[model samples]
Target chain A: MNSLSLSIIGFGNVGRGVAEVLYTKMPHFKKKYGINIKVVSITDTSATIWDQEAINLREAIETKNHFGSLKFWGNEYEVYKLDPMEVVKEIDADVIIDVTNDKNASKWHLEALKRGKGVVTSNKPPVVFDYKELVDLANSKNLPYLFEATVMAGTPIINLLKEEILADSVKRISGVFNGTTTFILTSIETGMTFKEALKQAQTAGIAERDPSNDLKGIDAAYKATILHHLAFYPIDFKEVHIEGIENLSEEEIREAKKEGTPFRLVATVEEGKVEIKPKKVYENGPLAVSGTSNVAVIETDLLGELMLKGSGAGIKETASGVVGDIIRAAVSIYKYL
Target chain B: MNSLSLSIIGFGNVGRGVAEVLYTKMPHFKKKYGINIKVVSITDTSATIWDQEAINLREAIETKNHFGSLKFWGNEYEVYKLDPMEVVKEIDADVIIDVTNDKNASKWHLEALKRGKGVVTSNKPPVVFDYKELVDLANSKNLPYLFEATVMAGTPIINLLKEEILADSVKRISGVFNGTTTFILTSIETGMTFKEALKQAQTAGIAERDPSNDLKGIDAAYKATILHHLAFYPIDFKEVHIEGIENLSEEEIREAKKEGTPFRLVATVEEGKVEIKPKKVYENGPLAVSGTSNVAVIETDLLGELMLKGSGAGIKETASGVVGDIIRAAVSIYKYL
Candidate 1:
C-alpha cells in the first residue's frame, strides 16, 4: 500500500496541534490501520519546504519550535519562499490541510479539490459562503472536502447532522454555536458590562483581539450557513434573523432568569430559513441547559430533536476535529486504492 | 431529472414512519432540492402491492388505517401475496426499504444490491452481522445500502462517525449506545429493582419483550462494531470487554448516586480495541450529563473529545435519520449524474 503524503498549509495553533497529534499517533495509526502518513510539505506565509521522500515529523516540529520557521531546517529538501497558491499546487501531496487563520484560504481548498487533492479545513468562510460550489466540486472529483473543525470545533455537528441525524427535514437548529460569544454573554449575565465581558473573554483566551465577529454573531452565522448547506437544505443567511448579545442589557438577563429562563446565543435553521440570535430559553429547553458549554439543538421532523454539546473551541478540541478529518481522509484514500 | 422510485419492504412501525415522513415532506424536498421521491410499492408478510405509476401516499395511509394493510387499498395498484425474495426482484424500485423484523434479511439486502438496486433499511441484523459484505456489495454496485435508522434511531451516530468525525485515529469511542438498556439502568438508579426496572422499560416501550440483546449489552456491542467498521478502523466484538446492567444491584446504584455518580452502560472503542460495559460516571463526566438520553463520547487523538446526545430511538427519530440518508444519497447521485 502506498503511504499517504500530506501537506500542512498553515502553521497556526491548529496546524501545529494537528502536527502534534499526527506525530504522537503515527506509530499507532501505522500499526493498526496499516498506513504510513508522512508530512511531505509545510507552507506558511513566510516559507515553504518540500521533502517528497517524507520529512521527519519530529525534526520538523523541533525546527519549527527552535527557529520558528522551516528556513533553518535546511536539509537536502527543496525549500522555496513562494506564495500560498503556488505551494498548494506544487506540493506533491495527496492531502492538503488548510488550517490558515485567513478565512479566504477556504477558496484555496476548492482549488486543491479541483487539482484532485483531498481538502480538510478548519477554515469556515468559503464553506459558509460557497458551500454548494465546493461540495459540487469535491463530488465531481470524487474527493473528500471536509470541514469538521468549522463548527463547534471537536464536536461532531457537521457529521452528526449530515450522516447520523439524516433528518427528514430540520424543523429548527438552535443552540450556542459560538463559544467566545457564549462566554462573553454568560459573563454579562453575571453583572459585567459588554466591554468588561469582552475583556474577561480575552483574558480567558476565548475571545480574539478583534471581537467583532463573535459579538455580531457573524461567526455563528457562518457555522449555521455551512451546516445548512451540508444538510443539503438551502438556507439564505440574509433572511436569517440575528440578535447578538451586544444589545442585551443586564436588566433583561436578570428578568429572564427571574422568569426561570436563561438567555443563550442561538443559531437556528429551519424550513429553508436560518436565524442566529440571542433568545430566552425556558428551564426545560436544551439551550437553557447548554450554559457556557457550547451546544447545538438540531430539531428535525423525523428525529424529533437532538443536541450535541462540548467545548466548542480550544487547541485540543479544534486539533481533535482536524485529526479526525485527517484520519477520515487517510482511510478514504486507503479504501479507494 | 428522474424521480426516485421506492418500495417499502415491510409495513411495520419504521416502514410506516418512513412513508409518513416522505409523504409529508415530499413537497418541501421537491420544491427545495428539485428531487421527486415517490413510493411505488409496498410489501409485508401478508401481501405485496405495486404500481408502475405513483402510489397515493395519502390514500395508502388512509387504507392502512382502515384495513390495517396497504394490500387492501383496492384496484388502483397491483397487489399480490409473494415471498420477500420475490418481491425484492419484482418491485422495480430504485431503492428497497427493508423494515422487516427479520434479522436474517442480510441475504435479501445483498440480493437487492446484486440486482443493482439500492437499499435503505431499519433492520439491524444484516448490517450488524455482515456489514463488510453488505458494504462491499453496495460498493460494487455503486448503490447506497443505508441503515441510518438501525441503531440510534435518527441520531446519525453511524454517519457522524463515518463521514464527519473522521479522526486521524479514533483513540476511544464510549457511549450509552443502547436506549432500552439505558432506560432500564436509569429506572434502576431511580430506586426500581432490576426486574421492576426491566418491566417499566418494557411498559414504556423502551425495551423489547426479549430484551436480552439490550440488557446483555449485545445491542450496544453491535452498534460499536458498526461504528468502528464505518470509521474504517478494525474492531472485533469478541476482543471487546463486555459487561451489562444485568449484574448490578439496587444498592450499588444507590451508593453511586450518593457519591454524585451515575451508572451508565457505555460501549468504548479505543486504539483498535473495544469495550462495552456498565460504568460509574462522576457528575462532571460526559456520561453523567447524558441522563436518559442516548449519548456517545467520541475521543480521538486529534479532535479531542465530543459528545452526541438525543432521542436514541423511536420511529420519528429513526425515520428522520433514514430521510437524511435519502437526501444525502440524492445529493450524491445528483453530483454523480
Candidate 2:
C-alpha cells in the first residue's frame, strides 16, 4: 500500500494543526487502518518545502517554531519561495489540501480536479465562492472535493446531511454556523457591548483580527451558502439575507430575554431559499438552546428532525474534521485505486 | 449504470415497509444519484416470490394486505418457499436484505459474503452472535454487511459513530438500545404496573409477542454486543451483565423520579467491557432526556460526548434505517464497483 502523499497549500494555524495530527497520529492510524499518510510538501506565500521520500516533520516543526519558515531548514529537502500554483504542480502529491485564505483558491482546487488529483480544503472562502463549479468538477472527475472543516469545524454536518441522513425532503436547515459571531452574540446577550463582545471574542481566539466578517454576519452567510449548495439546493450568496450581531443593542437583547426568547445569529435554508440573519427565538426553538456551542438542526421528512451540537471551532476540532476527511478520502482511495 | 437488484429475505412488517420506501423513492434516487433500485425477489417462511425484471410491488403490497402473505401475488417470474440460504445463492441479487427473526442468521450472512454478495440486515441476531467473523468476512470480500437498523432504528447511531463523528478512542457507548423495554419502563413510570406496562407496550406495537428477550434485558444486551463490536472493542455478550426492566417495584420508579432521576435500562460499555442494566440517571443526563425515544450517547477522547436520539423502533423508522443502508450500499457500489 503506497502512502497517500499530501501537499498542504498553507502553513497557517489549521494547516500546521493538520500536520501535527498526521505526525502524532500517523503510527496509530497506520496500526489501526493500514493508512500510511505523509505530508510530503508544504507551500505558503513566504516559503515552500518538498521531499519526495517523506520530509522530516520534526525538523519542519522545529524550523517553523524557530525561523517561522521551512526555507531555512538546510539542504535536506527541496525548498522554494514560489506561488502555491507552482507548488501544486511540482509536488508529487496525490492530494492538494487548499488551506490558503485566498478566495480564488477555489479555482486552483478546480484546476487540481481537472488534473485528476483530489482536493481537500479547509478554506471557507473558496467553497463559499464557487461551490457548484467545484462540486461539478469533482463529480466530473469522480474525485472527492471534501471541505469537512469549512462550515462547523469538526461537526460532520456535510456528510450527515449528504450521505447518512438522506432525507426524502429537507424542510429546513438552521444553526449557529459561525463561532466568532456566536461568541460575540453570546457575550452581548450576557450584557457586553458590541465592541466589548468583539474584543472578548478576539481574546478568546474566536474572532479574526479584522472582525468585520464575524460582526457583519458575512462569515455565517458564506457558510450557509456552502451548506445550502452541498444540500443539492443552490442559493445565491447575495440572495442569502444577512443580519449581523453588530446592530443588536443591549436593550433589544434584554427585551428579547424578557419575552422568554434569546437573540441568536441564525442561518437557515428552507424550501431552497437561504436566510442568514440574527433573529430572536423562543425557548422552544432549537437555535434558542444553541448558545455559545454551535448547533445545526436539520428538519427532514424521513428522519423527522435531527440536531448536531458541539464545539464549532478550534485547532483540535478543526484538525479532527480535516483528519476525518483524510480518512474518508483514504477509504475512497482504498476502494478505487 | 445498472439498477440495484435487491432480494428481501423476510416479508415481514419491516420488509414490506422497505419495499414501500424503495417503490416510492426509486425514481428520485435514480434521477438524483442515478440509482435504479428494484426489489427482484422476496421470501417469507410461508412463501417466496421472484421476478428478474422487477417484482410488482403494488401487487405484493395488495397480497400482503389481503392474504397476509406474498404468495397471492402470483408468480410472474419465479416463486418458492425455500430456505434463506437457498435464496442467498439462487436469487440473482446484488444485495440480500435479511430481516429474518432468526438469531442464527449470522451464519447465512457469512455464507452470502463467501458467495461475493453484499448483505444489509435489520436482524440484530447475526451481529450479536458473531460480529468479528462477519466483519472480517465482509472486509475480506470487500463487501458491505451493514446493519444500521440493528441498534437504533432510524437514529443513524452506527454510521454516526463509524463515519460522521470520527472519535479518537471512544471511551464509552451507552444508550436505550431496546425500545420495548423503554416503552414498558416509560409506562411503568406513568403509574402503570409491570404487567399493565407490558400489555400497553404490546398494544402500542412496542413489544413483541414473545417479550421475554426485552423484559429480561436480553434484547438490549444483543444490541450492546453489536455496538461494542462496531466500536472495535472486544465485548462478548456473556460478559455484558444483563438486568432488564423486570421485577422493578413501583416504589423504586417513584424514588428514582423523586431524586430528579429516572430509571432507564441502559446498555453501557466502558474500558473494553460491557454492562447492560437499568440505572438511575439525572434529568440532564442523556438517558433521562430520552424517554420512550431511543438514545445513544458516545463519549470519545477527541469529540467529547455526542448523543443521537430518535424513535427507537417502528416499522417506518426501522424501514428508514434499511433504506438508508440501501442508499449507502448503492453509493458504495457506485464508488467501488
Candidate 3:
C-alpha cells in the first residue's frame, strides 16, 4: 500500500513529461496520498525498458533524451522489442498509463483493465468508443479507469465532474475544447488571414504537419462525446453534429470580431446530444477565455454555473492531469487492497 | 454500508438547503456512491428534532417554511427543547454537518471529531482558527473532516486543489473570496459611490445586516487562511494582513476603473503568508471575474495557473459543496468499515 507500480504505454513527449513530473513530485504524492508511484515498465512503439523492480524514471527519461529512444538506449537484450500489447499484458503493474496519443492504444487500455489493473489514459479512442464498457469493467473490478486528459488536457473537466457526480446532475456543458483550433481562430481575429493563421500556428507548433483533425472538428467532437457520456448519457461518436472551423471566411471572422463576438470552436454537450461548431462566443461570459486557454461551463441543477479554465494543451500541463489520475488510481488500489 | 446516518446541527437556510439537496439527490447519491444518507437528527439553535430512523428532510423543510421554526411543527414529545451541544453529544449519527455560522459551533466541531464522527461543515471558525488541530485529530482517527464550503461555498476551490495536490506544488493561490465585497466593488465600478454600492448590495440581499465582517476583509482573510493551510502550510488567523474596502474612496475606485484594472478585494495565499486587500485585478486574467462570482487562480508548478470560478453565495450552491463532502465522508466510512 505504500507504493504502487505503473507501466507507461508510451515513451513520447507526454510520457517523458509524466516521468519528469513524478520524479519532481514523488515526495508530494507520498505525503498527500500516502502512496508512491513507480514506473515498472516504459514503452515506445517498437521497444520497451522493463524492470520488475521499478525503473528509475529519471534515468529512463535521460536515456530516451540522450539516445533518441529507449529502443537505442539499451543493448538489444536489455531493450526488448515488445509492443504495447505485450507490455500491457505481461507487465506486473497496478496501473497502465496510456499516453500513446493515438487510436491504436485503445485495445491496450481494455487489455489492462481485463487483467485487473487500473488504467489512466490520455488517449481518447478508448473513452470515445467504449465509454460505458470500459467504465463498467473497471467498476466491476473495483478499479479506476480515468481519462482526464482526453478532453481538456489538465484543465480538469473530467475530474471536476467526478466530484460533481453525487452532488448534482449536469444540465449542459459547453466549452472551447481544442487548443489548436482556438489558437488558429484567435490568430485570425488578430487580422491574420486563415492561411496566414494556419501557417503561424504550424510554425508555433500549435498545429500539426497534417492539421485536418483539428480543422475538421474531429478532435473537438471526440472530446464532446467523452463529456456527453460523463455528464449526461453515453453517445455515439457519429451522433455528434460537427461543423469545423475550416469553412470560416476571413470576412465573416472580421465581421464577428467587429461585433465583439469573436468566433470560437464551441463544443456543447446536452442531455442526448453533442455538437461541435465554430460560433461567436459570449462577449463576457465563461466561454470568452482568450489565448489557448480552455474553458468549460458546467450548468448543474444545484450549483447554477461553474467555470473551469486552464491551459488545454502542453506536455507538462497534460502530465499534471495524467499524474493526478495516477495518484487517484494508486490511492484506489491502496484503499481497496 | 448502504446507509449513512447524519446529525445536521444547524437548521438555518444553508442547513435547510443541505437537507433539500440531499432529499432531491437521494436517488442520485444512492445510485452513484452506493450509499443512502439519512438524517438521524436535526437541530436548530433552540430546539432539536430527533429521529432514529431516517427523517423526511422535505417534510422538515416544509415545516420550517410553513411555520417560523421547527419549534411549533412537532408535538412536545417529538421536538425536545434541546440546544446544539445536547444534540451533538447524544445524537446517533455517522457524520455531523455543522452549518451554524458562528464561533460557538467551533467547540461542537472538536467534540464531534472527538466522538469519532466525521464532520462536513460550512462553518468557518473551526477552519480559520483551529485548522491543524481539527484536521490532525480527524486524520489521527482515519476520519474525514472536510470544510469545502468554508472558503468559497461550493465553488470547488478546495476540492479542485485536493485533486491537484499530488500533481503539482502550489506556488500561490489568489482569488476573489468574498462575494459581498465583489458585488460592492463591481457596483462601484459602474460609477456608483461606495455608500450607494453598499446599499445596492444590501437591497439585493448580498450583504448582511452588520456587513463589517465582509467590509473589514475579515471573511476574505479567513478564507485566505484556509487556502494557505490547504495549499502551502498551516497559518495563524492573525498572520494574514487585512485591509477593508470600507475606506475606499469613490475617486480612487473610478481612477482604477478608468485605468482598466478594476478594484477587487483579492485574497492571496502564498508560502508562509496570507494576505487580503482591495487591489486591482488583472484586466484579462483569471481574476477578471465580475459580479459575485468567486474565482481562484492556483499557480501550480506543473500546470501553470488553474482557475476555478463559481457563485460564491447562495443556499443551493453551498449545499452542493457540503453534500459533496457528505458523500465523500460516507464513501470513506463505508470503505474503512
Candidate 4:
C-alpha cells in the first residue's frame, strides 16, 4: 500500500483531534483507498517532535494533553526546541495540516506550498492573510491547498463549493460564521446581558480569554474573507466592514424577536463585497440557527438557495474537516502524482 | 487540452437542462480543468441522434422543446429509431449521462459500466434497484458512479457524504425527501384539503399526472433506499415502510401547526432501517421546509449534525447535479486513465 505522510502544526485541541481521528480512521481509509497514512512530525509552539518511522499518535496526544506542550514528549522520542518553520524545512511529508491560530502560521503554510507539500488547514489567519498567494503557489506546484475548516469548521462548505457547486455560480452567501458571537447573542436573547453571556461562553471554553476578535466581528470577517475569495474574488480581510455584537442589548434582541426577526451576527458576501454585522433574520429563515451552530445560505444562479447548517466550533468537528481535507488531498496525490 | 465525450440517455427536460448547462459552462470547465466536453449523442424514448462532432445542444434543446420528442431531428443530423441500450452499446464516450425515469435504465447503466464508461445520473430507479451491484462494478473498474440528483437534485448531499464525511461514521439521516408531498402538505397547512393541494401541485407541474408514487411515498422511499445504502447498508426499496400524506386532512395539519409542530413527509434512516412517512417536525427544525424545498439532516460520529437544504425539483437544479457528477467522473478518467 502507498503510505501518505503528514506533518501537523499545532498540537492543541484541533491538532490532537486530527491525530485521534487519523488513529481511529486509518484502517477505514487504508481499506478503502489502498493507502496507509503516517504522522511524521508534530510541531507545537515550544518545540517540535519528529519520528520518521511514524510518530506514536496516541502517545503524542496523551503527552500534549497531560503537559500542555509537545516539549513533554516521551524521552525516547526525538523532541527538539526547534522553530515551527525549522521543522517545516527539516521534516519530509506529503501534507502539512495547520490547525494553529498563530499569526505566523501562514509563513510555514507558504513555505510548505513552495516546497510542493499539499496544505490542509483549519487555521483562519493563514488563509485570510495569504489565500490568493497560497492558492496560486499550490496551483503552480500542482498541489491541493484546501482549508475546509477555516470557515464553518468541518461543515464542508468549502468542499461543497469546490467539489459540488462548480456547475452553478454562487450569487450570494450569508451566514452566522462566528460561534462565540452566536453564543453570546443567543444567550442575550434568553435575558442574559452581553457581559454575562460572554462570561458564560468563556467559562464553557467557547470563547477565548480575550474575545475581542469575535466581539468585534473580525473573526467572522476573516472567515467571510476566505469564503468570498473562494466563491467570488480576493479581497483583503480589512476590506470587509465589521460590526460586533458587543453593543447588542438584550432589549434590542427582545424587540427584534417581538417583531418576528432575530438578530444574528451575519456575514454577507454579495456583489463583490463582504459585510459583517448584526442583521435581523426571519425566524424561519435558514440563517436562524440556535446555540453555537453555524449556518450558511448560499444563493446560486441556477439552484436558487441552498443551505448548510452545522457546528463551526469544537475540536472533533474542526478535525473532521481537516482530516477530510487531508484525505481529499491524499486521494488527489494518489491519483495524479 | 483534453476532450470529454458524453452520451446522454433520455433527452427529456433534465437532458435539455444538462445541455444548457454544458453549453453555457463549457468555457468555465475548459479554463478550470483544461477539458472541453461534448455531447456525442442524445436519445429519447422513440429515437436516438448521433453526432461524433458534438450534437448542437442549443438546437437539440430547441428542437426537443418545439417537437414532442427527439425523433424530429433536423435533416442535417443522423437520427434513427435506435434503442437506448443499442445506443449505449455503440456510443464512443467516456461517460453515460442518464436522466430518464425509465424502470430498466439500470440495464443501460450496467452495460455502460461493463463497457468501461463512468455512469452519472439523476435517475433513481436504477440506483434503488441495482445500487450494490453497480457500485461494486464501478469500484472494481476504478470508475465513478454518482447519483447526486437522485436525492435532492443538485443539493450535493451525496458529494458531501463522499468527499467530506469519509473520516467519520454517519449515524442517521432524516429528510423531507419528496417535493410533491412537501408541496401538497405545506399547501394543506395553508387551508387546503389533500385532494385540493394535490390538484394544485399537479396543475403547477410539481406532481406527475399519475402521482401515485409520490402520494404513496414511494419516491421518498427510493431516495431513502439509495441514501441508506450509501450511509450504512443495502436494502431493497420495498423494505422501507412508507406512509404518505394522503390520509391527512387540513384539520390535522392545522392542529399540528397550532401545537407548534408541522406535518412533513419525512424519510428517516437510522439503525440500518429506512422509514418514509408523514411525521411531526418542530416548526424550526431543519426538515421543516416550506414550498417544494428538500432538506436532509445527517448525523455523524464526530461532526454532530450536518444539514443540507435545496430545491429537490426543477430541470436546471437536477441537471446541475448530473453535470457535476459527470465532471467528477470525467476528472477521474482524465487524471488516472
lDDT of 4 by residue, A258-301 (tens): 78898899999986799999999998877777877999999998
TM-score of chain B of 4: 0.97
* lDDT (Cα, tens digit) per residue for candidate 2, span A1-337: 7688888888877777778877787887887777778888887667888877887777777777788876777765667776788766666777888877787886678778877778888888878778788888888888888988887777777777777865255678888877777666667777888789878877877788998887788888888888888775766777778888777788897778778787888898776678878788866655764434677887766666667766677776777788888877776776666
Candidate 1's residue-wise lDDT over B1-337, tens digit each? 6788777788877777788888888888787677877788888767877776877777776777789976687774677887789878877877788888797898889888999788888787788778888888898878988887776777777777666654445667777778777677667777888899888888888788899988888888877777777664545556767787788888988788778887888887766666788888876666764434777777665455666777777877777767777776675566555
Indicate the residue-level lDDT of A184 in model 1.
Answer: 68
Runs off by more than 4 Å, candidate 2: A66-79, A282-285, A289-292, A334-337, B74-79, B165-167, B334-337
Poorest stretch of ten by lDDT in candidate 3 chain A: A71-80
Give candidate 4's error at residue B76 in angstroms: 3.2
Docking category of candidate 1: acceptable
**Candidate with more favorable, higher lDDT: 1 or 4:** 4
lDDT per residue, candidate 1, A1-337, as tens digits? 6799888888767878888878887777677667878888888667877788887777777778888887787566667886678867877789888888786776678778888999889998777777778888898888988888889887777766655543455667777788777676667667887788789889888888999888888888888887777664555667667767778887887678778787777787766777888888875655764433677887766666677777688777788788877877888788777
After superposition on all C-alphas, the RMSD of every candidate to the true structure, in Å, is: 4.9, 2.7, 1.9, 2.0
**Which candidate number has the best lDDT?**
4
Q: Please give, for residues B17-99, the per-residue lDDT of candidate 4 as tens digits.
A: 99999998888878776777989999898788888989989898888889988888898778877787888898798899988
Which candidate's DockQ is highest?
Answer: 4
Error of 3 at B230 (Å): 0.6
lDDT of predicted model 4: 0.87
TM-score order, best first, reads 3, 4, 2, 1
lDDT of 3 by residue, A1-337 (tens): 4679899988888899999999988986787668977888899876888888788887888888998888776553377788889988877988999998777666787888899999999999889998888899898988899889887788788978876435878899989988888888778877898889999989988888899999999999998899888887789898889999988898888788789898889998999999999989766767866667888988888888888888888899889889988988887788766
Q: Candidates 2 and 4: which is better by lDDT?
A: 4
